[model samples]
Every structure is written in C-alpha cells, then in structure tokens.
Target: MIETHSSSLKTDQMFINLGPQHPSTHGVLRLGITLDGEVIVKAEPDVGYLHRGTEKLCEVRGYHHCVVVTDRWDYVSAMTNNLVFCLAAEKLMGLEIPARANYLRVAMCELNRIASHLLFFGTYGIDIGAFTPFLHAFREREMVLDLFEMVCGARMTYNYIRLGGVMADAPPGWADKTSEFLKYFKTKLREYDDLLSFNPIFLDRTKKVGIITAEQALDWGLSGPNLRGSGVSYDVRKTFPYSIYDKLDFKVCVGEAGSCWDRYYVRMREMAESVKIVEQCLAALPSGDIMAKGVAKIPTPLPGEAYAHVEGARGDLGIYLVSDGTSCPYRLHVRAPSYINLAILQEALVGLRVADMIAVLGSIDIVLGEVDR
Candidate 1:
C-alpha cells in the first residue's frame, strides 16, 4: 500500500499592517505592506496618527504662541523648530537680531542637532538588534540636555529661541560646560565608530540594502542625510546661508551609494561638522544685547508674505507666513522635511526582506510628529 498522493501548494500575496502601534516604527506611522513569502511586494506608509493640525492652529495663535506650536512639529530638535519660525516672523517684521544673538542661535541649534542624531544612533542600533549602543549613545545625549537646561529651563520643548532673539543669554558657566561636552563628545564619536558604526553585524543588515539612486532620491523629494547620502551637495545652510551659518566654517557631510548604511553614516559624520560649527560660534561670540531694541511685545508686522527655511536636523524645514497686519497670522504653512522624506519609503521598502524593514525605516530616521503636523 505504497500509494502516493499528489498535491500542489499555491502561494498568494498576503497583506499585513506594520503599524500605527508597532514599536519597530519610529513613531505613530502605519505601513500597509504586502508580502510574498518574506519579501515585501508593495509598501505604503500611512501617516497622520499624531496629527493636531499644527499649521492651522498656528494661524489663530499669536506670533509668540506660534513658536510654542512649532515645538511640537519636530519635537526632538525643537530648537531648530523655534529658530525657523522666529526667522520667518522676524523677516516679516524687519527686525535685526544682534550679532551675539545670532551666534547663540547657531550654537543652540547645532547642539540640538547633535542631540537629535544621538537619539537616532541609539534607536537605529536597537532596531538592528544591538542594544549596547543605545546605552552609549544616551550617555552622551544626557550631557547635551544638561547644557540645554542650563540655558532654557525646559529640556525638550524649549521656547527659548524667539522672534527677535533668544529668550536670554546662556548662563555664565554655560559656555565652559558646552566646550567641555564638545571635547568629550568628539572622543565618543570614535568610540561609537568602534562600537556600532563599523560593526560587522550592522553592515550585514544595512550595507547596499534599500538602495536609492541620486536621481530617484531627487525625484522623490528627499532631503537631509537621505539626500546627501545620494551624493547631492544641496544643504539649505550652505546654499541659502541663513542666520550665522554663512559666517561659520564647516563641511557638509555627503555619502555615496544611497544605501541605508550611507544614510546612517552621513548623520554620524554630520554630528562632527555640527560640533565644528558650535565651537566656532562659541569662540567668536560677539558682545551685544541678546534681544533687539525697540521691538514690540505684541509684534504686528505689515501686510505681507514671507518664506523662511532652515537646515533642520531632519532637513529643509520652512515656514510660509502670511500676515494680515494682525498679531495672528493670516496663514501659516509648514514644509516639514520628515513628511517629504517619508514618501520614498513606499518604493524603497519593496523587494526588501521583512527582517530588513526595520533597518531601512530606522535609517530614514523620521519623527512622526513632523509627519503628522
């Protein structure tokens, strides 16, 4: 009774939801993924889980309160958020910020960029199955927070950068503490290199995975490290030169291949460039009042429209502000880089194995707050 049965196994594409709730996702984002076996056939990112209509909210709020709302957009790098809004508002009002104030603005924003990238470093390592790097990254990040708290009482959502200038000058001991942290952070960057940046296991998962060519990247409207990773030399700071960035000397970190690893390493190198910018600003910090003189408490700029963009930690963050000769803005629209950067994921994630989904997503380093805002 050696009877044999013949059967044909059929496979169909299976659709699965990744998350608006999954921990692997950087924030509250939903990815509708279709898989055949373990490979993704198609991917769609559905954002807006954390939406609060921040741009609409900004229209009704006063100029002072608008800065506060901008904090919620890219919550991790709030100083840059504060700076872009203030720059747009200041442009409308025709106010001249002091030399010292501009230097302080550059220093604060650069320090915040370091902190934000440290967060990405730690979390991306965890996403790729290395936990020890998380511990090391946070140890240095805490020092940056300590420096921020010394200037602005708040650690995260600093309403410190304002319309004409910063909230106040950094405290007497703040510069020395920041200088010491910068010295220490540079050494840690090397430590990070040995620990995770060049780790063999990390490379296996990231290198040459989810490759986006320079033309593809530009077509998808990618920016920040993602754009630079594709060998594009377009940095808003270098091209537009807002605030004191023109005066500061530093190199733009660019990468080749446009792989997940390239994007990740570009951010790592940019931290060093940011360190140089901060050090230069601190060394050349001028003597003057932190706030501009003769600015009204309730600033009512003339009827007009002004657009201001900055090189945020994520990318080109801009504010399109329209004033109707009122304290409240007539319209406020945000060009959030995270929202733009996240769009390429649909194409990038396809053909990648399920195991690599997290590595690619984590390398994009998006904060959903900005996407949803």
Candidate 2:
C-alpha cells in the first residue's frame, strides 16, 4: 500500500553550487542551490568553513583577554564587537562606566558602523558590476579607519574597547579630523546615489528581483537593513538604548520597497544618521577618565548568565556569558547577525535569477568571518 515513483517524478530543476570560492560571494560561503532554469528554487547554505571554535577559545582565556578573539568575528565592526562583550561583562559585574567613557564608546561604535556600511556599499556595488562605488566607499572607509588608528593604534583588528571603558582617550584634534571626514562622507553619499542608486541598469538589476516581504522577513528573524527594507522600523539602538543611545537623537531609516534598492537605500540613509550621532558625541564629548576603576583586574561577577547586544552595523551583535565566580567565563555565546541573516537566503533566493541571487546576497552584506565563527 505504498506509492512509488521513479526518475520520471523528478523535476528538471538542477542544483548549482555557488562558492566556497566565487567572486561575488565575498568570502568562503557555499550555497547548494537548486535552480529551475535561471530561477533559484532552493538554497542550502553550507557554512563552518571558517569556524575556529571561538566560543571555546574564549572560555580558556581570561575575561579581559578575549577581546582579540571577538575582533575576528566581525572585523569590520570590531569596536562594536568588543563593546558587546565588554558590556555583557560590565553588566554582570555591576560596573558603571563614566559619562565620558559612555559617550566615547558611542562615538567609536558609530564610526565603526559607518565604516562597516561603507564596506557593504563597496562590495554590493562590486557584485552588481559597478566598480566605482567600491573605490569611493573604500576611500571614505579609510578616513574612519585613520581616525580609529589614531585613537587605538590598531586598524582592522582593533581591540580598542575594553571592560568598564575604552583602552584610551581620544587624542586631541581627533574630533576635528573626524568632523572633517563626516562632511566628506555626506558628499560621497550623494555622489554614490548619482553614480549607481538610480541607474537604469542598477535599478533593472535589483528592483522586483530577490524580493522578500515584510511578513516573511519577520518570520525568518531578519534584522538591520534586511528587515528595514521590508518597512520594519525596529532598531536595536532605539529598542535597547544602551551606552547613552537614549541621549542621542537619530532617525531609523526604513524602506518600503522590499527589494535590493530599498536595502541599499536603508543602509545609505543609516550612514547619514550615524553621522548625526557622531557629530553629537563629538560636540558634547566630556573630558575625563577613559578607563574605569576596578577594570585592570579580571572581573568575576556572581554566578549567573547575562545577555548584552548592540546595534552593530550589520544587525544585533549579542554576547551571552555565564559566570561561575571565576576570572574565566563558564560559557560564552555570540549571536552573530550575519549568520542569522544568511539563514534566510534560501527563502530570499527561491524565485530569483542567478545574478539577482548574488545581488541579494551582497545586499544582505554578510561577513563570512562572523557567519562561520
């Protein structure tokens, strides 16, 4: 009483593997994709190629020593990554960072957000065959990196933020230079729109392609530009309001289009809002101690678990740590936004063309470092 079917029941759809090494993928992400001709039918992401047991590694290290490991997870937003970990530890230890330190943290994390988004702008443009935006975005990104370097001494793998406060104060004139860069960044954003945002070819390539509705996005736990593109106004900064975000005034950019263009616009506008926040932090920057007391020693809170998250450039970068009254954490878990965002690629790709698939993936702006680790 069983129904059986032979090869005749199989559809004509064929599976195509997109990158453990492909140009547009931006890193080592392999998609076992099923295609109905040029349209994607299913996409199964094959990850863990870059996993190095970061959580396990953090457990073996001292509480103050895992900052470097956090840096590698979302290297583009390394400061934000460090902030999340530090905040979690701070919360557990009942530490109160100074107003100056809080504002500095906000400013640095905003700068990190801008730089991270610029990288997204660059790579997304590259994926869609617009070579110029990548260069322009990188140019702006370099300025932010320079400012960060002056403050922290390291560029990409910056373990700048630490528990209780930052590693150091902003070097004098850093604010002025940062303000100058912000002005340049605004002008570059306009240039980007003129160059590619509304280009007929770019529009044709993105609009109505790789569409994901608001309901579908929410159902799949999408966040950041991906969720905002579908018209959701949720921002972790507004929702959670940590590190004096409550004191700052900024708008959360959302798009109604639910397409690649909408996602692109959401991020572009977000950069401008971040500029506003940075300018505020710079103008009202308090002059005082950078590092808080009792931070030099490894802190061990009472045995418990706490979760702290930040509105990272990509999405909510959450750190969950468990303490057992020791200098070393009993357990550590990172809720990497890129990893969660990538989970919805199969749904996003279901009816899209191969080229649009790349565009959609690029628009999602994944960092393989975060995804696999």
Candidate 3:
C-alpha cells in the first residue's frame, strides 16, 4: 500500500485506506477512512478507479450505437439500462413503439430487476459470512439469466432493447419458462427468508449497522430501494409512470428505519413485487409487433434534448440525450443510481466495525460498472 500525506486532514485522526481490493468493496472501490480506534472517525470515498468514460464514448457514436455502451453502465441489469437508453432515444426521435413492445419492455425490465436484486442478496450473504444464501440466491438468478439468453442472444452485456423496440420478440415457450421460473422463485425466496432473514446472526450483524436516517438519505439524492428502505414511498415507476409501468399493478417496498436490515428487507420484499409485475405483464401481453414500425428509417429526427428514466433494479436509471438533428447525439448523460447510492457509504460506515462494512455495502446493492462509469 502506498501512503500519501493529505493537506486536508488533522494529524490526530488515523487515516487509513480500507479498499481498492477489500472483499466487501463489491468491486474495485477504494475507501479512504479515518479511524478512531475500532470506530471510524470519518470516511472518504476514492472513486475513478473503475472509470471507463462511457459518457464521452457516446459523443462520438451515433444514437443507435450508444445503446450498447449503456449496457455496460450496470452490467447486472443490462436490459434495464438498454430500456432507459432506447426510451430516451425514442423520445428524441418522437418515435412511437408498439403496445406489445411496451409490455415486453416492462416484463423484461421487471425480470431483470429481480435478477439484479438476487445478485445483491447473494453477494450480501457472502459478505456477511453466510455462503449458502449467496448460492441459493444465485441459483434462482441463473434461471432468470436463462430466460434472458432465450430472448436475447447473449446473457450479460445484452443490448436487447433497440431504438424503437426490442431486438426481437420473446421466443417460443418464453412465457411458460418465465412463469415456471417465477413459481420456483417464490419457493426459493421463502427458503431464503427462513435461511437468512430472521436469523439472529444476520440481524445482529445488520440491524443497527450503517444506519442512515430518511432525511440524510434524501439529502444525498439516494434512490430506488436504498431511499425506499428509509421510509420514502417514492418510486420512479409510481411517480414518473413510464412505459407500461402505469398500467402494471405492483407495490413499492419500504422500510421504517434506514439500516442495513431495512435495505435488506426492502430488496427482499421487492423481489415478490417484481415477480407480481412480471406475472401481470406476461398475462396481459398482447400479440402485436414486438419491433416498432419504420425502424429501418435510420432514426434521423429534428435536433432536440430528451430525458427518460426507468425504475431499474437498483433505482432510477436515467438517460439524457441532446440531438443536433443528426444521427448522433451531441451530448449524452446517464443518472447512474449505483454511483449515487454508493456515495452514502462514507456517511453510513462511520463508527461501524470493519465486519459490518460488507453488510452495509452489500445492502446498498451497488454495481461497480455504474459506479466507475
């Protein structure tokens, strides 16, 4: 480890770098923390290690080509990222997607949400010293990935959603496969609850650790389950009502106290809600053009700016595009929920034991791809 003197600190505080390779970091995230013995005096996050300059990459590429780059923002929920980017591009071009395509987007996005949450649940369990739950959660998540592969040709980094609609419609038996997975998912979630949720060990480790009040969370611009876990009922789907979200029936899971457990329970309950949304979307799926009409028209539109956001697995995934009446966007920006959500770590981890660090970070459900992008 390389130690550098900071001009911004008092000499009395023991400044330590907690990560860049620590197990609880989730990825290549480095935390510069000040320690007052076992308690953290203060914490400062050192980001940019994982920066890939995805936004800058967008400036040089056409609107259609940028969708693939969005997939890398949050690798776990590539579909959700695709949906946000495509929606924003469509808005800019003033394109109208088919009703069937809208329903498909909802179904795929909700399924991906559950899959992303399952990854967090698994990784959180491993971080908290329970390996079995991680495996169990992943086992279920793999089923969802299989569904993705069936619909899209690839699993991760799927640029499935196109400028006007999805790359393709659901394959044969897609609904049946998804329905079966959901059924098994319901049972597995119960097993997970019994295995981890009420366990004394988990509760003891997570209950009061990394506690952040609702006000602090809001002040920090936290979104998705992290904000909702803090007693906020604000959901992008409920508030913004994009795509088919307004037509779907689902509940936003919230927590009373913004602790690690609150975040965990919020995600746990959210899986059920996502499952509910998927079922409704699948059942109501109309048979029509899954791909939009006039997609081959090259998407050349009048220059304008548009922003579209979706309630992704993590939180609100937003895309901002400025068009110059050309094939490419003059400016493109993404509101990465993970990047913002991870900002609370320093505030949340202060005074907590090193052991609790992983639990807190995992509870936040951050994707390093988004954080570093």
Candidate 4:
C-alpha cells in the first residue's frame, strides 16, 4: 500500500468459481480459480459433482449387467467403456470371443471414437468463440449415431459390447452405409481445417497459449490425444494390442509443441486414422458367430482377479474385476482416463491468463461423468 509496483496499485489475488453452471467450463465442472489480476495464479478443479458410485454398484450387480453400468461412466465413448469391462470379465471367465465378434468390437469402438472426437471438435470450436464449426461437426456426428442405432437400437448409452461378444451382429446393409459415410467424412477433414484449425484467429488463440511439455504430460498421467499431443505416443490399441487392433493398420498421430492447438489437432488427426481402421475392418470383416457360445445366463467366475484396458476416446480406460466364485463381483474398480487426465488441470492452469483457462481446459476434453465416477 505504501509503494506501488508501477504506475498502478498492486493487485490482490481474487478467487472465483468458473463453473457448475458456466458454459465454457464444459459439463458441470467447477474450477476454483485464483486470479492475480488477469493472470491465473492457481486453478483447482472441483469434481464429484456428478458422481454415480458406478464401481460400487458393479459389485452388487451380475457380471453381465455391469456392462450396461459401465456405459454411463463415459457416455461419450460408451463402446470403449463397454469393451473394457467385457474384456476384464471375459478374462476372469477365460472365454474365447469369436473372430467376428472381436472384429465387430474393434469396428464399433473405432466408430465410437470418431463420434466422441466429433463432439469435442464441435464444442471446442464453440469454447473458443467460433460458432460455425459446431454446426458442421454435429451434422456428421448424427450420421455416426444413425449407424449405431442401426445395429444396437440405442444411440448414446449403447450396451452393445458385452460379456462374451457384441449384443448382436450388424444387420443387412449396415456395412455399406458405413462405407458411404467414411468416403464422405474423409473430405470433411480438410473442410474443418478451413473452418477452425487454420483460421488465423484460431491459431493465435490456441497456439503457444497452453503449452504442456512432454515431461509435464507424463508426470500428470495423461493419455489418448492429451498424451499424444505432448508427443508421448502411448495408445493402448497400439501398445497393448487389445481386441483386433493388431490386425488393423493405422498411425499414431502426435504433436510437436504440446500447445492447445496440438491437443486439438491430435484428436482431429486421430479421426482420420479411425476412418482408416473402419475401412480396413469393413474390408476384412470376418465370418463367424457374433456372440461366443457356452457363456451361461448367470454364470459364476473363479476366485481371481482380472484387469483390462482400452485406448478410449478420452484416454486409457481400464476396469479391474474381482470374483469370489459368484455371479456377483467381489470388488470392482475403474481406472477411468477422464478421471486421471483431469488431475493435470490443477497444475497446468497455473501461470496463464484467466481467459486461456477455458482454452486449455477445452483442449484436454474432460467428460464430467467419467471424472466423477
């Protein structure tokens, strides 16, 4: 108070809540931000506003029913959620999923990844003050949903990937329709570049704004596009080779600078890879039973534990299942990527402009349901 730092008086740290209502925070997230004038001194992400106790519920429900419960955790990428739980339960039961079922699993999960990224593509544009891109992104997202509805009968919370295999095989004409969609989607990637990716204003707003170094991303346990953006190159599909991912061919896209643009662009490039995987899956669609035989309606697994993980649209989604030779699980745990990835925001948000907080948060692409679960 006695002496000013410059021509103006010294600014005091001000604490403010960013969401649980605000639109830019994405979902019901509440970011307790401490701002020293326009600069953010600290950012604390307050979660559990959407907790559903899904892991606890899984312990009481039958192994088969737990698949549906997994859907709500990451509703944006529900197929991966369905797949991870199924992989864990199947491992515990030691079941051999059919070749066709595995192919279908891969196809569905890849398609789901495309759909989830599209949501991010649209919403992220809106987060940064651009409105046109959201319209185009949703137009394509609806088509993907139509394909999901064609086979699974549910759009968002699809209980398709199951204990032994998928809920059912793809119906007639579904494959051809998906191929047509892919052909059209490949052209739209460039259109996105013109709309948002390369816009001068967008580049200025996102580039070099929220830079997360490769080291920081690793220390915070980031994954999926977040990790890839930081040049980590960790994809469970590529590294662990789950399901039929090893049979398919695709590249792992990464970023150099690890800025907000890098994270956003990683997802954009991943969509192209997903298109390639879907094309290959359709071309090499195996012939066999969709659901494995001999899995009982209410079967019990041996007294042991199994863990399975998949490269979810958000990141490394995993499930751990424990069985005590009963139809119900002895204990269940989830290593939700959204939950783990959200941790970095607490540290990453420091030392940035208050406005850049939204930019950085949007780039990470956290889904509140998965975070709070």
Q: Tell me, by TM-score, which candidate is best.
A: 4
lDDT of 3 by residue, 1-373 (tens): 9988776545566778877988788888888887765667787888888899999998888778888899888999898899999988888777889988988888888888898888888888888889998888888888899999999978799888888888899999999999999998898889889999999999999998788899999999999999998999999999999988888888888998899999999999999999999999889999989787777455666888999998888888888889888777888888999989988886888788766776788898888899888
Q: Provide TM-scores for the models.
A: 0.97, 0.96, 0.95, 0.98
Clashing pairs in 2: none
Candidate 1 has an lDDT of 0.93
Per-residue lDDT for 278 in model 1? 93
Better of 1 and 4 by lDDT: 1
Local distance difference test, per candidate? 0.93, 0.89, 0.87, 0.92
In the range 1-373, model 2's lDDT, one tens digit per residue, is 9998685565688988988998888789999999886878889989998999999999988888988899999888899999999999888888889989999999999999999999988888889998998888888888899999999998898898888888889888988899998888888889988988888999998887777799988898888888999899999999998889999999999999789889988998999999999999989998888888876476767999999998998888899999998888899999999999999987888877888888898999899999988
Give the worst 10-residue stretch by lDDT in candidate 2: 292-301
Model 1 misplaced regions, further than 4 Å: 1-10
Q: Which 10-residue window of candidate 4 scores lowest in summed lDDT?
A: 1-10
Which model, 1 or 4, shows the larger TM-score?
Answer: 4
